[model samples]
Target: MSESAQQIGEKSQVILHFDLKLNDGSAVDSTRVNNKPAKMVMGDGSLTPNFEKCLLGLSVGDKKAFSINANDAFGMPNPDNIYHVDRTKFASDAELKEGMIMGFAQPDGSEVPGIIRSVAGHSVTVDFNHPLAGQDVIFDVEIIDVK
Candidate 1:
């Protein structure tokens, strides 16, 4: 099958370098150097629709680049995601610091990463939401090859 018509369970290898940036053109993530090949399964829900669409009909040694809008990338952040926690949760001996990354449990029995926001007398405010929740992100994808 052609790269664009790749089906689920198809085994393929492709090397790609990509840049993730904010709408303001701030770089967030990129796999430019140390180039590596990534294997993907179609219909696994791993790649966003927009991203998948861009990958369609590609071939090995085919170098194609494209950009994706925020909605198709990480989506916007939700305000309801911010949360608060008790300072005592961190052992008395533990030092609470701002910008600390911690894992918090969610109702779905999943761990959500949170960043420490502030430390008050007895409370530690944390933002469990993704740091880019409210912002739109840009994805720069390049297809190095496809099987």
Candidate 2:
């Protein structure tokens, strides 16, 4: 490759390492620590629209860090996302405990994750909100490739 490469465009494919953190510096995820790079097309659903927008015009080997509000990143937590399911849904073989995340199948055959919040005698509350909802997040990214 030459020393100068064109900046990323709308349809470019990108490879990068990223660190996602909370305002308090708690690590949500990181590709650098895993020694793996992430690759994604610009307009694909793999990357959030806001996150992709941040990468536009960046060239290879560029590193940048930025912060975004929760609503723009993962979104605010919705009260409707909390569900109270019947305790019987869990069979004896399955464990029913708080803070346990489970995948539930929907009518469209897609699976969404739900975290158990509480377990009562006959009711179980599950929260479907993303774990990072309603929090400010900081993103640190290093562009490894832009094609």
Report lDDT per candidate.
Answer: 0.66, 0.89
Show the lowest summed lDDT stretch of 10 residues, model 2: 1-10
How far is 125's C-alpha from truth in model 2 (Å)?
Answer: 0.5
Best by lDDT: 2
Top candidate, metric TM-score: 2
**Which ten residues in a row are the worst by lDDT in model 1?**
5-14
For each candidate, give its TM-score against the true structure: 0.70, 0.92
Candidate 2 clashes: the total is: 0
- Over 1-147, each residue of candidate 2 has an lDDT whose tens digit, in order, gives 644454778888889999999999999899988799999989988889998888888888799998999989999999999999998777767788899999999999999999999998889999999988898899899999887
Writing each residue's lDDT as its tens digit, candidate 1 over 14-118 gives: 455667687678888777655654556545676666666766666545555465555566666666766677777777897779999878777899987888889
In candidate 2, position 145 carries an lDDT of 87
Model 1, residue 105: displacement in angstroms? 4.5
RMSD of 2: 1.7
